[model samples]
Target: MSTVAVPELAVVSSPWSLGPLHLSNRVVMGSMHTGLEVQDDGGAGMAAFYRERAAGGAACIITGGIAVSDEARGGPDFAVFGVGGADERFRAAVDAVHDEGSTILAQLFHAGRYALAAGMVDRHGAPQRVVAPSALPWAAARGVVPTELTAAEVERTIEDFAAAARSARDTGFDGVEIMASEGYLINQFQSPLTNLRDDEWGGSPERRRRFTVAVVEAVRAAVPDLAVTIRLSGADLMPGSSTDDEVDALVHDLLPLGLDGISVGIGWHESRTPTVQAAVPHGAWLAYASRIARVVRASDHPEVRVIASNRMTDLRDGEAVLADGLLDAVALARPFLADPAIVDRSLAGSFDLVNTCIGCNQACLDRSIIGAPVSCLVNPRAAREVAFPARPTTDPKRVDVVGGGPAGLAAAVDAARRGHHVTLWEASDRLGGQFDLAALVPGKEDYAATVRAARAELADRGATVHLGHPATVADLAGSDAVVVATGVVPRAVDVPGADLPHVLSYEQALRDGVPAGTVAIIGGGGIGVDTAAFLTESPDEARRATEFGARWDVDVAETVVGDVPQRLPAAHRTLRPGPDVTVLRRSGKFGQGVGITSRWVALGRLRDAGVRMVGGVQEYLRIEPGVLWIRDEHGDEVGVPADSVVVCAGQEPALPTGDEADGRPTDGLVTGLQAAGVPVAVVGGARDARSVDAVRATSEALEAVRRLAP
Candidate 1:
């Protein structure tokens, strides 16, 4: 196993004080919706989830946004406190955090227009009516215009916040945080674009600040003993939203209301800005928090500590941000999801073992948004902490895992940890199969971390990994059980001229580089879209410099445009005019298999790279030497001229075959192995071609190994 150098210790591990509350470290587990609540017994899963993070070394844990009122409820599964008469349910959770030597804060919120769209229903079983400061709808909310909140309703809402805070204190929570960010109810009133009332709650900047100030005062007075923190959107990023001056004035007004600290959350859900996705650089939103911190530090209310959030996974980066005095502490949500023991691992100087978040929100935010129980893409046992605890096998045996892809590696690690004698075989020299190609995608280099972690884990757990060796039925004869995880084999599309020299597979193109000039790519799934991104110019350093130079009327010359190398391969060489790439999908849309959280950003990047996308192809006529013929959705024959045609027509399961099989290869490994008088299980793409992603592959492998016990 390769060792990674630990970053120098800094303020991340140092003790800090948030008013009267004393913390063990600067690491705070920011609020993330886990959807773990039982909706009856409060939440056994929720309590266990917090306990895991607390045990790992978070100084503070903020509960997922809990509804303060019936109208404010985010969804049926969301945690509720004051209005639901279920405050007692959270007592166990708070006590569990305290027992773990960490302070827990309840985040109270009202979703407002976001609420109705979230499918939150009232106790009467009727759909909750959407309400906002004005009769405006969030752009994403479709045509669901919210009812304007009356003055009496506004007063009641403020009272509900105070009641929630009081209930949080009563329930043994050490602190309470008001969720005024993320275009929630409070933020709806804060943003000028959403709040268009001429009344006291809107119009002037001061009036727009009224609701937040009143809530702070009410909550502070109601729960004087408990710490009070307010989460504010440093920038809404929406058109006509609150300016920096307005935010500064609002902070200035709220600072005098006995606030404990401020957590700066950036961007709104309605805004077309990239906030926490993979494409967004780490600490991209730190400047927003810095601005607020600067205002607070320079003000008479210097005691108000600022907490920065969004895309802060690495503790080293957090340390840098703290050392620069950008913010008092860093709040991480997704990192905790990826690895609950992030703080402990960083403190122990085992940086390599830390499962860093790849910023793929597939299992976390995407699932939560659809009212599903949230889990981590890499770490499957995130929310199921109690349910999925690793246990040793009662009856251990020798296990042979064929293939060293994500599925095979996962199985080897799990089997070895369970006291089984495990050996993993790979036909290739490396472990990661298609996952290596996935890492090569633009803005997706973080995926390599997962591959590295898996490799390190295989080594640490004593799993014998044999590279460049394919396991046969004879090799697994002595093993108690065999797991066939050979993954997938790319299938060729049944089209004329597919065998042309200019036409290449997506995998081949990635490995040997795309040919220069115009290229037509077939298929528009995740692979095709990612391949398009790989072929196009990355909108990073060079693009930025070019844009900057163009704007300033400066010749970029040597810096932006360099002399072309003459020794490069024809396939590896990029032409002077650059590549004109067009992606064709047989389906209606591109990036169909992409996670909802990052798909928009990925497509946006592809768009910015001048990649032409055409979907709903009626038929593919054929691929010629320098031109590809296809019928559009309207049955119009389009001759797309190209230097090369790259086929990303997807993959098929590479199940074991030959004399080891009962009949055909598609009969599957389980049937084949069983016929040969051997017990066998199949996982990942080998089990089902559609199950090609990391999330499914890892999960299926883990479950398969667990079932193999005894």
Candidate 2:
């Protein structure tokens, strides 16, 4: 594989100014919630997380949204800025970011109606009531209407914003940004669908803009010296939401009210649009920033810089957009999460080593939504910086790693970095066991980059890699310690006629192509859903277009639909139909264990591809030549006729089995080896059968190597 050469960045590394604040560069760390505040140090873990990014050369760091009022809190773990007893607690966070020579901005927010449904409690330990412009619930709130804020409550809310900004200024923060996007309280007041009041807060465009404008004015008045920015939704992207013109008009009205800068945030939580997912085209939201930049340049407040955000993965992309004068600076949230030194490395021209974010959102947004601490899928030390330390070994030893999958590769590289001689052996010709299959799934090509990076790191660290060489007990005879990461194998089902040629495991189907005909997949887990999508070739625009044309009887030759047939004359004729696929599972829900952030996109793609999904199966009776018999939820046996049946019933730990081995779980390998006077450890899927994702496997590998080094 050829390397993707990094282009020379032009304006991305240059210094920029946002009103009174002077940034060292154009790269800004956008605000993202990190559940690290659950620690006991009064947000010290969260502070350390931000400090790392600042020390790595991010020009400015905007802290995650901090609630101003007790009723505005999202949860107990969320940080609070101006609440009565939390002044010193937030000052420590600001001091940490400032110690790294980076300007820190506190993002003050109020969750509003979303807070009540989020189970947020007040200072007195009672469930907070949701408040908005009108008595409407967000789509995710399950029809629970919010209490309308009275006229006096609206006045008090504005005062709360003022107090938050004043508290930030007193706490030594350089600035404060009003969290006015992403379906939060301020955005609810600006959006037409959420703000349906007949009072001064809602009614027409001017009345709707009253709440935001008043908050800005009050915050600016409260902290005249501090930089006051507002994060606005460039496009709500929801039905009956604010339009581009309305956003433009709102920006026009807010600029005169002492706004220092504007950060463009795309989409809301309830938006049906694909905003930050991997499937979204790179720089797809740049045009929205450009539209706002055009509006900002036209207004009298030209000093208010426009920051472009969403799906910006590389500095070259930011440089290109910055050179085009569409945006003054670029904000990156996930990229910083993936690599804290992203800016410094790009500036030093070490692009190959920089770990770019794959936009998976698995560990970041998805985990945060479930009230878990945010961590990066590729970088295990993101949130747990203190817990996962990388220290050189005082006494180096020879290490043998028996696997070339993610866990083994990680172990080899970490051991080599820690002054140990390491050798990694793989039974297969290539690396990345199930990860390779995962990369082949639709909209997941970015996963291949991870494998490439691991391979490159191993080569650079001088770790010996032996492919197609299955390790035996003899290989570990001379080694001081051994790490086994043999990974997992698909569990076999005990249904009748399971040995039929028509039945294939998920790995088998991925290795050998799926048969062309009706297919029934057992187990609606992540693997099964991904396999169904793989067989259907979902989200492939050309395939979807062809299928659409075939279903609706539209002639592609005459009509120019979706700009495909007109551009490529042979697209219509070269289109091939995918196989008819159905997914069967014993559980009620499909795609279990899939992240909430990307689950809808995955399931929506399956639905669009005409895939049938039936869950709540009581039993699998049997699998015949071209038929699968299963008992449905109604206790009635049904025969599902298909050309092939694929089983993705989940994985089991692959333990050693031979005369020399006792066939025990891999965790016992360490104790057995220690009994024999050899220091050995187990990592990755071999360590456990559940929750063996890339993040856990890599972290376990690093920890295991650290333990064995000394």
Error of 2 at 559 (Å): 26
Q: What is the lDDT of residue 95 in candidate 2?
A: 83
Runs of candidate 1 exceeding 4 Å displacement: 1-7, 39-42, 82-89, 117-120, 391-397, 417-420, 539-579, 658-669, 676-678
Clash pairs, candidate 1, are none
Among the numbered candidates, top TM-score falls to 1
lDDT over C-alpha atoms for residue 242 of model 1: 88
Error of 1 at 402 (Å): 2.9
lDDT of 1 by residue, 232-347 (tens): 99888776788889999999999988898999998777667777787665566767788899999999999888998887677876777787654788899999988887888787
Q: Candidate 2: where is the Cα deviation over 4 Å?
A: 1-7, 82-89, 116-121, 124-129, 139-145, 390-400, 410-422, 477-481, 500-502, 538-579, 618-626, 629-641, 659-672, 690-696
254: Cα error in model 2, Å: 1.7
Q: Return the TM-score for each candidate structure.
A: 0.90, 0.87
For candidate 1, the C-alpha RMSD (Å) to the true structure equals 4.8
Error of 1 at 304 (Å): 1.6
Q: Which pairs clash in model 2?
A: none
Q: Return the number of clashes found in candidate 1.
A: 0
